[model samples]
Target: AIAEAIFRHLAPRATPLAGRHALVTAGPTHEPIDPVRYLANRSSGRQGYEIAGALAALGARVTLVSGPVDLPAPPGVALRRVETASQMLAACRDALPADIAVCAAAVADWRVAQEATRKIKKAQGAPPPVLALVPNPDILAELSTPGPDRPALVVGFAAETDSVAQHAAAKRARKGCDWIVANDVRPETGIMGGMENEVILITADGAEQWPRMDKRAVATHLAGRIAAFFTAQRSIA
Candidate 1:
Protein backbone atom coordinates (compact mmCIF):
# COMPACT_ATOMS: atom_id res chain seq x y z
CA ALA A 1 0.00 0.00 0.00
CA ILE A 2 2.74 2.39 0.97
CA ALA A 3 4.80 1.43 -2.06
CA GLU A 4 1.92 2.08 -4.42
CA ALA A 5 1.31 5.48 -2.87
CA ILE A 6 4.98 6.35 -3.23
CA PHE A 7 5.06 5.25 -6.86
CA ARG A 8 2.08 7.38 -7.73
CA HIS A 9 3.55 10.35 -5.90
CA LEU A 10 6.88 9.96 -7.71
CA ALA A 11 5.29 9.61 -11.15
CA PRO A 12 5.48 12.61 -13.43
CA ARG A 13 2.45 14.83 -13.15
CA ALA A 14 2.62 15.81 -16.80
CA THR A 15 0.07 14.11 -19.02
CA PRO A 16 2.10 11.53 -20.90
CA LEU A 17 -0.78 10.42 -23.09
CA ALA A 18 -2.26 13.88 -23.51
CA GLY A 19 -2.87 13.56 -27.22
CA ARG A 20 -2.85 9.80 -27.38
CA HIS A 21 -5.83 7.46 -27.28
CA ALA A 22 -6.02 4.01 -25.71
CA LEU A 23 -8.57 1.29 -26.50
CA VAL A 24 -9.40 -1.46 -24.00
CA THR A 25 -11.82 -4.40 -23.88
CA ALA A 26 -12.92 -5.81 -20.54
CA GLY A 27 -15.16 -8.50 -18.93
CA PRO A 28 -16.65 -11.58 -20.54
CA THR A 29 -18.77 -11.64 -23.66
CA HIS A 30 -22.08 -13.45 -23.32
CA GLU A 31 -22.85 -15.57 -26.34
CA PRO A 32 -26.55 -16.16 -26.60
CA ILE A 33 -27.58 -19.82 -26.75
CA ASP A 34 -31.24 -18.95 -26.67
CA PRO A 35 -33.48 -15.98 -26.08
CA VAL A 36 -32.90 -16.19 -22.34
CA ARG A 37 -29.87 -18.45 -22.19
CA TYR A 38 -26.23 -17.50 -22.81
CA LEU A 39 -22.75 -18.90 -22.49
CA ALA A 40 -20.10 -16.84 -20.70
CA ASN A 41 -16.93 -17.03 -18.70
CA ARG A 42 -16.11 -16.07 -15.12
CA SER A 43 -14.19 -12.92 -15.89
CA SER A 44 -15.12 -10.21 -13.40
CA GLY A 45 -13.17 -7.56 -15.36
CA ARG A 46 -11.24 -6.34 -12.32
CA GLN A 47 -7.88 -6.50 -14.08
CA GLY A 48 -9.08 -4.82 -17.24
CA TYR A 49 -10.91 -2.14 -15.32
CA GLU A 50 -7.80 -1.35 -13.31
CA ILE A 51 -5.66 -1.26 -16.42
CA ALA A 52 -8.01 1.20 -18.05
CA GLY A 53 -8.02 3.42 -14.96
CA ALA A 54 -4.22 3.28 -14.88
CA LEU A 55 -3.98 4.40 -18.48
CA ALA A 56 -6.50 7.15 -17.95
CA ALA A 57 -4.62 8.49 -14.93
CA LEU A 58 -1.63 9.06 -17.22
CA GLY A 59 -3.79 11.44 -19.34
CA ALA A 60 -4.69 8.97 -22.06
CA ARG A 61 -8.02 9.41 -23.74
CA VAL A 62 -9.32 5.93 -23.06
CA THR A 63 -12.19 4.12 -24.75
CA LEU A 64 -13.26 1.07 -22.77
CA VAL A 65 -15.39 -1.40 -24.70
CA SER A 66 -16.72 -3.58 -21.95
CA GLY A 67 -18.94 -6.62 -21.85
CA PRO A 68 -21.56 -7.26 -19.14
CA VAL A 69 -20.11 -6.34 -15.73
CA ASP A 70 -21.39 -4.68 -12.58
CA LEU A 71 -18.50 -2.29 -12.08
CA PRO A 72 -18.69 1.47 -12.24
CA ALA A 73 -17.04 3.35 -15.09
CA PRO A 74 -13.56 4.69 -14.52
CA PRO A 75 -13.14 8.44 -14.24
CA GLY A 76 -12.30 10.38 -17.39
CA VAL A 77 -12.97 7.38 -19.61
CA ALA A 78 -15.44 6.86 -22.40
CA LEU A 79 -17.39 3.68 -21.62
CA ARG A 80 -18.96 1.67 -24.42
CA ARG A 81 -21.10 -1.17 -23.12
CA VAL A 82 -21.58 -4.37 -25.12
CA GLU A 83 -22.90 -7.89 -24.63
CA THR A 84 -21.57 -10.27 -27.27
CA ALA A 85 -18.29 -10.57 -29.11
CA SER A 86 -19.62 -9.08 -32.31
CA GLN A 87 -20.87 -5.97 -30.58
CA MET A 88 -17.59 -5.57 -28.77
CA LEU A 89 -15.67 -5.85 -32.03
CA ALA A 90 -17.83 -3.22 -33.67
CA ALA A 91 -17.39 -0.89 -30.75
CA CYS A 92 -13.62 -1.27 -30.92
CA ARG A 93 -13.50 -0.62 -34.68
CA ASP A 94 -15.54 2.52 -34.24
CA ALA A 95 -12.98 3.79 -31.71
CA LEU A 96 -10.05 3.26 -34.02
CA PRO A 97 -6.91 5.25 -34.65
CA ALA A 98 -5.74 4.52 -31.14
CA ASP A 99 -2.16 4.81 -29.91
CA ILE A 100 -2.45 1.70 -27.71
CA ALA A 101 -4.81 -1.29 -27.68
CA VAL A 102 -5.42 -3.76 -24.86
CA CYS A 103 -7.39 -6.95 -25.49
CA ALA A 104 -8.46 -7.84 -21.97
CA ALA A 105 -11.96 -9.14 -22.52
CA ALA A 106 -12.47 -12.89 -22.16
CA VAL A 107 -14.39 -13.14 -25.38
CA ALA A 108 -16.43 -16.26 -25.99
CA ASP A 109 -14.79 -18.43 -28.62
CA TRP A 110 -18.05 -19.58 -30.21
CA ARG A 111 -21.62 -18.38 -30.41
CA VAL A 112 -24.79 -20.09 -31.46
CA ALA A 113 -24.94 -20.35 -35.25
CA GLN A 114 -28.65 -19.66 -35.19
CA GLU A 115 -30.29 -17.96 -32.26
CA ALA A 116 -33.80 -18.88 -31.28
CA THR A 117 -36.21 -15.97 -31.24
CA ARG A 118 -38.14 -17.38 -28.29
CA LYS A 119 -37.31 -19.39 -25.21
CA ILE A 120 -36.44 -23.01 -25.85
CA LYS A 121 -39.06 -25.43 -24.54
CA LYS A 122 -38.34 -28.41 -22.32
CA ALA A 123 -40.21 -31.55 -23.30
CA GLN A 124 -40.84 -34.70 -21.31
CA GLY A 125 -38.78 -37.75 -22.39
CA ALA A 126 -37.47 -35.81 -25.39
CA PRO A 127 -33.94 -35.29 -26.57
CA PRO A 128 -32.33 -31.95 -25.67
CA PRO A 129 -31.95 -29.24 -28.26
CA VAL A 130 -28.74 -29.12 -30.23
CA LEU A 131 -26.91 -25.81 -30.52
CA ALA A 132 -24.69 -25.33 -33.55
CA LEU A 133 -21.82 -23.09 -32.70
CA VAL A 134 -19.62 -20.87 -34.87
CA PRO A 135 -16.29 -19.21 -34.27
CA ASN A 136 -16.40 -15.58 -33.21
CA PRO A 137 -14.55 -12.75 -34.92
CA ASP A 138 -10.97 -12.57 -33.69
CA ILE A 139 -10.85 -9.01 -32.40
CA LEU A 140 -7.34 -9.18 -31.01
CA ALA A 141 -5.96 -10.55 -34.27
CA GLU A 142 -7.67 -7.78 -36.19
CA LEU A 143 -6.18 -5.13 -33.93
CA SER A 144 -2.70 -6.63 -34.21
CA THR A 145 -2.86 -7.01 -37.97
CA PRO A 146 -0.33 -4.75 -39.65
CA GLY A 147 -1.94 -1.99 -41.60
CA PRO A 148 -3.01 1.63 -41.43
CA ASP A 149 -4.59 2.63 -38.10
CA ARG A 150 -2.77 -0.11 -36.24
CA PRO A 151 -2.05 1.00 -32.71
CA ALA A 152 1.60 1.74 -31.95
CA LEU A 153 1.41 -0.80 -29.09
CA VAL A 154 -0.86 -3.84 -28.93
CA VAL A 155 -1.22 -5.83 -25.72
CA GLY A 156 -3.25 -8.98 -25.15
CA PHE A 157 -4.22 -11.04 -22.12
CA ALA A 158 -4.14 -14.83 -21.97
CA ALA A 159 -5.94 -16.66 -19.18
CA GLU A 160 -4.74 -20.23 -19.02
CA THR A 161 -5.32 -23.23 -16.74
CA ASP A 162 -2.00 -24.84 -17.49
CA SER A 163 1.40 -24.00 -18.93
CA VAL A 164 0.67 -20.30 -18.64
CA ALA A 165 3.92 -18.95 -20.06
CA GLN A 166 4.13 -21.44 -22.92
CA HIS A 167 0.60 -20.83 -24.09
CA ALA A 168 0.82 -17.05 -23.78
CA ALA A 169 4.08 -16.84 -25.75
CA ALA A 170 2.57 -18.88 -28.55
CA LYS A 171 -0.60 -16.83 -28.45
CA ARG A 172 1.37 -13.58 -28.72
CA ALA A 173 3.10 -14.87 -31.84
CA ARG A 174 -0.04 -16.36 -33.36
CA LYS A 175 -2.07 -13.24 -32.73
CA GLY A 176 0.74 -10.92 -33.90
CA CYS A 177 0.47 -8.84 -30.75
CA ASP A 178 3.38 -6.87 -29.28
CA TRP A 179 2.89 -8.26 -25.75
CA ILE A 180 0.88 -10.81 -23.80
CA VAL A 181 0.04 -10.69 -20.13
CA ALA A 182 -0.35 -14.30 -19.03
CA ASN A 183 -2.01 -15.46 -15.84
CA ASP A 184 -3.27 -18.71 -14.40
CA VAL A 185 -7.00 -18.85 -14.07
CA ARG A 186 -7.38 -22.24 -12.50
CA PRO A 187 -10.13 -22.36 -9.92
CA GLU A 188 -7.67 -22.74 -7.11
CA THR A 189 -5.84 -19.58 -8.08
CA GLY A 190 -8.85 -17.47 -7.14
CA ILE A 191 -7.94 -15.00 -9.89
CA MET A 192 -10.92 -15.62 -12.10
CA GLY A 193 -13.24 -13.51 -9.98
CA GLY A 194 -10.92 -12.40 -7.21
CA MET A 195 -9.32 -9.08 -6.32
CA GLU A 196 -5.62 -9.97 -6.63
CA ASN A 197 -3.60 -11.29 -9.57
CA GLU A 198 -0.22 -12.76 -10.51
CA VAL A 199 0.92 -12.34 -14.10
CA ILE A 200 3.81 -12.91 -16.43
CA LEU A 201 4.33 -10.11 -18.93
CA ILE A 202 5.65 -11.44 -22.23
CA THR A 203 7.24 -9.23 -24.86
CA ALA A 204 9.62 -9.60 -27.78
CA ASP A 205 12.46 -9.06 -25.36
CA GLY A 206 11.28 -11.81 -22.95
CA ALA A 207 8.94 -12.50 -20.07
CA GLU A 208 8.90 -11.22 -16.49
CA GLN A 209 6.94 -12.84 -13.69
CA TRP A 210 5.13 -10.49 -11.36
CA PRO A 211 4.28 -11.22 -7.76
CA ARG A 212 0.75 -11.65 -6.57
CA MET A 213 -0.79 -8.32 -5.67
CA ASP A 214 -3.93 -6.25 -5.91
CA LYS A 215 -5.18 -5.70 -9.43
CA ARG A 216 -4.69 -1.96 -9.02
CA ALA A 217 -1.01 -2.38 -8.24
CA VAL A 218 -0.49 -4.34 -11.43
CA ALA A 219 -2.32 -1.65 -13.34
CA THR A 220 -0.12 1.06 -11.89
CA HIS A 221 2.98 -0.88 -12.88
CA LEU A 222 1.75 -1.42 -16.43
CA ALA A 223 0.74 2.22 -16.79
CA GLY A 224 4.19 3.32 -15.68
CA ARG A 225 5.75 1.06 -18.26
CA ILE A 226 3.53 2.48 -20.97
CA ALA A 227 4.41 6.04 -20.00
CA ALA A 228 8.10 5.20 -20.13
CA PHE A 229 7.69 3.65 -23.57
CA PHE A 230 6.09 6.78 -25.01
CA THR A 231 8.66 8.97 -23.37
CA ALA A 232 11.47 6.96 -24.90
CA GLN A 233 9.85 7.04 -28.32
CA ARG A 234 9.51 10.78 -28.16
CA SER A 235 13.13 11.17 -27.12
CA ILE A 236 14.24 9.07 -30.09
CA ALA A 237 12.20 11.14 -32.48
Candidate 2:
Protein backbone atom coordinates (compact mmCIF):
# COMPACT_ATOMS: atom_id res chain seq x y z
CA ALA A 1 0.00 0.00 0.00
CA ILE A 2 1.07 3.63 -0.48
CA ALA A 3 0.61 4.16 3.24
CA GLU A 4 2.99 1.32 3.97
CA ALA A 5 5.62 2.84 1.68
CA ILE A 6 5.25 6.19 3.44
CA PHE A 7 5.66 4.52 6.78
CA ARG A 8 8.81 2.76 5.63
CA HIS A 9 10.37 6.01 4.39
CA LEU A 10 9.50 7.82 7.60
CA ALA A 11 10.99 5.03 9.69
CA PRO A 12 14.37 5.29 8.00
CA ARG A 13 14.39 9.09 8.24
CA ALA A 14 14.07 8.61 11.97
CA THR A 15 17.57 7.19 11.94
CA PRO A 16 19.10 10.67 11.88
CA LEU A 17 19.17 10.54 15.64
CA ALA A 18 20.79 7.15 15.43
CA GLY A 19 24.27 6.74 16.87
CA ARG A 20 23.75 9.77 19.07
CA HIS A 21 23.54 9.61 22.85
CA ALA A 22 20.90 11.59 24.76
CA LEU A 23 20.38 12.14 28.49
CA VAL A 24 16.97 13.18 29.87
CA THR A 25 15.77 13.80 33.43
CA ALA A 26 12.09 13.49 34.33
CA GLY A 27 9.41 13.67 37.06
CA PRO A 28 9.28 15.07 40.58
CA THR A 29 11.33 13.55 43.37
CA HIS A 30 9.77 12.81 46.70
CA GLU A 31 11.76 13.71 49.80
CA PRO A 32 10.51 11.71 52.71
CA ILE A 33 10.27 13.48 56.06
CA ASP A 34 8.59 10.88 58.21
CA PRO A 35 7.56 7.38 57.20
CA VAL A 36 4.40 8.98 55.80
CA ARG A 37 5.21 12.64 55.28
CA TYR A 38 7.10 13.68 52.17
CA LEU A 39 7.79 16.73 50.02
CA ALA A 40 7.04 16.67 46.29
CA ASN A 41 5.84 18.73 43.35
CA ARG A 42 3.19 18.53 40.64
CA SER A 43 5.37 17.23 37.84
CA SER A 44 3.49 14.60 35.83
CA GLY A 45 6.47 13.41 33.78
CA ARG A 46 4.40 13.56 30.61
CA GLN A 47 6.64 15.92 28.65
CA GLY A 48 9.82 14.16 29.72
CA TYR A 49 8.44 10.72 28.86
CA GLU A 50 7.33 11.98 25.47
CA ILE A 51 10.75 13.50 24.84
CA ALA A 52 12.44 10.21 25.72
CA GLY A 53 10.20 8.33 23.34
CA ALA A 54 10.90 10.85 20.61
CA LEU A 55 14.63 10.60 21.13
CA ALA A 56 14.52 6.82 21.02
CA ALA A 57 12.54 6.84 17.82
CA LEU A 58 15.21 9.06 16.32
CA GLY A 59 17.67 6.18 16.90
CA ALA A 60 19.59 7.88 19.72
CA ARG A 61 20.86 6.01 22.72
CA VAL A 62 18.83 7.55 25.51
CA THR A 63 19.71 7.53 29.19
CA LEU A 64 16.61 8.59 31.11
CA VAL A 65 17.18 9.54 34.74
CA SER A 66 13.67 9.40 36.08
CA GLY A 67 12.25 10.41 39.40
CA PRO A 68 9.19 8.69 40.79
CA VAL A 69 6.91 8.19 37.79
CA ASP A 70 4.58 5.51 36.45
CA LEU A 71 5.54 5.73 32.79
CA PRO A 72 7.11 2.74 31.12
CA ALA A 73 10.57 2.95 29.64
CA PRO A 74 10.86 3.82 25.98
CA PRO A 75 11.94 1.05 23.69
CA GLY A 76 15.71 0.74 23.28
CA VAL A 77 16.31 3.38 25.95
CA ALA A 78 18.17 2.74 29.20
CA LEU A 79 16.46 4.13 32.28
CA ARG A 80 17.88 4.95 35.71
CA ARG A 81 15.29 5.31 38.43
CA VAL A 82 16.07 7.79 41.21
CA GLU A 83 14.17 9.14 44.22
CA THR A 84 16.04 12.32 45.04
CA ALA A 85 17.78 15.18 43.25
CA SER A 86 21.16 14.03 44.55
CA GLN A 87 20.54 10.53 43.27
CA MET A 88 19.46 11.88 39.93
CA LEU A 89 22.61 13.98 39.70
CA ALA A 90 24.74 10.94 40.45
CA ALA A 91 23.00 8.94 37.77
CA CYS A 92 23.54 11.70 35.21
CA ARG A 93 27.21 11.92 36.11
CA ASP A 94 27.52 8.21 35.58
CA ALA A 95 25.89 8.42 32.15
CA LEU A 96 28.51 10.96 31.07
CA PRO A 97 29.42 12.78 27.88
CA ALA A 98 26.08 12.44 26.12
CA ASP A 99 25.48 14.35 22.90
CA ILE A 100 22.44 16.06 24.36
CA ALA A 101 21.11 16.50 27.89
CA VAL A 102 17.48 17.41 28.48
CA CYS A 103 16.55 18.59 31.98
CA ALA A 104 12.79 18.01 32.18
CA ALA A 105 12.61 16.88 35.76
CA ALA A 106 10.90 19.29 38.18
CA VAL A 107 13.56 18.86 40.83
CA ALA A 108 12.58 20.00 44.28
CA ASP A 109 14.09 23.34 45.18
CA TRP A 110 14.53 22.24 48.79
CA ARG A 111 14.45 19.20 51.07
CA VAL A 112 13.95 18.65 54.74
CA ALA A 113 17.23 18.52 56.65
CA GLN A 114 16.33 15.48 58.71
CA GLU A 115 13.80 12.79 58.02
CA ALA A 116 11.96 11.16 60.92
CA THR A 117 12.49 7.41 60.89
CA ARG A 118 9.11 6.98 62.57
CA LYS A 119 5.95 8.96 62.00
CA ILE A 120 5.34 11.66 64.59
CA LYS A 121 2.15 11.11 66.54
CA LYS A 122 -0.29 13.97 66.77
CA ALA A 123 -0.92 15.48 70.19
CA GLN A 124 -3.99 17.41 71.21
CA GLY A 125 -3.43 21.21 71.36
CA ALA A 126 0.04 20.78 69.86
CA PRO A 127 1.56 23.23 67.39
CA PRO A 128 2.04 22.13 63.80
CA PRO A 129 5.24 20.26 63.03
CA VAL A 130 8.11 22.40 61.75
CA LEU A 131 10.27 21.29 58.83
CA ALA A 132 13.69 22.71 58.13
CA LEU A 133 14.25 23.04 54.43
CA VAL A 134 17.52 23.24 52.51
CA PRO A 135 18.17 24.07 48.89
CA ASN A 136 19.00 21.33 46.43
CA PRO A 137 21.53 21.70 43.68
CA ASP A 138 20.32 23.48 40.55
CA ILE A 139 20.99 20.59 38.24
CA LEU A 140 20.67 22.52 34.99
CA ALA A 141 22.86 25.34 36.23
CA GLU A 142 25.46 22.86 37.35
CA LEU A 143 25.47 21.06 34.02
CA SER A 144 25.68 24.23 31.96
CA THR A 145 28.24 25.94 34.14
CA PRO A 146 31.16 25.45 31.72
CA GLY A 147 32.05 22.13 33.24
CA PRO A 148 34.26 19.33 32.00
CA ASP A 149 32.60 16.65 29.88
CA ARG A 150 29.43 18.69 29.54
CA PRO A 151 27.09 17.65 26.78
CA ALA A 152 27.27 19.34 23.41
CA LEU A 153 23.77 20.72 23.91
CA VAL A 154 21.90 21.28 27.16
CA VAL A 155 18.10 21.85 27.08
CA GLY A 156 16.22 23.07 30.12
CA PHE A 157 12.57 23.74 30.86
CA ALA A 158 11.24 26.94 32.38
CA ALA A 159 7.71 26.36 33.61
CA GLU A 160 6.68 29.87 34.56
CA THR A 161 3.22 30.96 35.59
CA ASP A 162 3.84 34.61 34.66
CA SER A 163 5.87 36.52 32.07
CA VAL A 164 6.62 33.12 30.65
CA ALA A 165 8.72 34.15 27.69
CA GLN A 166 10.72 36.84 29.47
CA HIS A 167 11.37 34.65 32.45
CA ALA A 168 12.52 31.82 30.22
CA ALA A 169 14.96 34.12 28.49
CA ALA A 170 16.37 35.21 31.81
CA LYS A 171 16.57 31.62 32.99
CA ARG A 172 18.51 30.61 29.89
CA ALA A 173 20.98 33.41 30.54
CA ARG A 174 21.21 32.61 34.25
CA LYS A 175 21.54 28.85 33.82
CA GLY A 176 23.77 29.15 30.73
CA CYS A 177 21.92 26.35 28.98
CA ASP A 178 21.92 26.20 25.22
CA TRP A 179 18.12 26.20 25.03
CA ILE A 180 15.15 26.68 27.31
CA VAL A 181 11.60 25.58 26.57
CA ALA A 182 9.27 28.09 28.17
CA ASN A 183 5.68 27.36 29.10
CA ASP A 184 3.02 29.19 31.06
CA VAL A 185 1.49 26.86 33.63
CA ARG A 186 -1.38 29.09 34.63
CA PRO A 187 -4.31 26.81 35.49
CA GLU A 188 -6.28 27.94 32.47
CA THR A 189 -3.54 26.88 30.08
CA GLY A 190 -4.08 23.23 30.98
CA ILE A 191 -0.46 22.50 30.09
CA MET A 192 0.35 20.36 33.10
CA GLY A 193 -0.39 16.69 32.31
CA GLY A 194 -2.46 17.86 29.35
CA MET A 195 -1.69 16.64 25.86
CA GLU A 196 -1.25 20.20 24.56
CA ASN A 197 1.12 23.11 25.11
CA GLU A 198 1.92 26.63 23.96
CA VAL A 199 5.67 26.93 24.15
CA ILE A 200 8.45 29.34 23.36
CA LEU A 201 11.89 28.10 22.47
CA ILE A 202 14.53 30.41 23.96
CA THR A 203 18.10 30.36 22.80
CA ALA A 204 21.02 32.73 22.35
CA ASP A 205 19.68 33.58 18.92
CA GLY A 206 16.18 34.61 20.04
CA ALA A 207 12.87 33.44 21.42
CA GLU A 208 10.48 31.75 19.03
CA GLN A 209 6.95 30.90 20.11
CA TRP A 210 5.00 28.06 18.58
CA PRO A 211 1.26 28.08 18.30
CA ARG A 212 -0.61 25.96 20.79
CA MET A 213 -0.36 22.38 19.70
CA ASP A 214 -0.48 18.84 20.97
CA LYS A 215 2.51 17.50 22.83
CA ARG A 216 3.31 15.17 19.95
CA ALA A 217 3.52 18.10 17.57
CA VAL A 218 5.73 20.00 19.97
CA ALA A 219 7.97 16.99 20.36
CA THR A 220 8.24 16.56 16.62
CA HIS A 221 9.10 20.22 16.11
CA LEU A 222 11.70 20.12 18.88
CA ALA A 223 13.19 16.92 17.56
CA GLY A 224 13.46 18.47 14.14
CA ARG A 225 15.19 21.51 15.56
CA ILE A 226 17.62 19.33 17.45
CA ALA A 227 18.35 17.35 14.33
CA ALA A 228 18.99 20.55 12.41
CA PHE A 229 21.38 21.77 15.05
CA PHE A 230 23.28 18.51 14.93
CA THR A 231 23.34 18.57 11.19
CA ALA A 232 24.73 22.08 11.18
CA GLN A 233 27.39 21.06 13.64
CA ARG A 234 28.25 18.07 11.52
CA SER A 235 28.67 20.27 8.49
CA ILE A 236 30.92 22.58 10.45
CA ALA A 237 32.96 19.68 11.70
Q: Largest TM-score belongs to which candidate?
A: 1
Q: What is the TM-score of each candidate against the true structure?
A: 0.94, 0.92
RMSD of each predicted structure: 4.0, 3.2
Model 1 alpha-carbon miss at residue 23, Å: 0.3
Instruction: Give the count of colliding residue pairs in each prediction.
Output: 0, 0
Q: For candidate 2, write residues 96-139 as lDDT tens digits.
A: 88889999899998989988899988889999888999998888
Candidate 1 wrong stretches, greater than 4 Å: 1-13
> Per-residue CA lDDT of candidate 1, range 71-93, in tens?
98898789999999999999999
lDDT of 2 at 182: 90
Score each candidate by Cα lDDT: 0.92, 0.87
Task: For candidate 1, report its TM-score.
Answer: 0.94
Model 1 / residue 11 / CA error / Å: 9.9
C-alpha lDDT (0 to 100) for residue 137 of candidate 1? 99
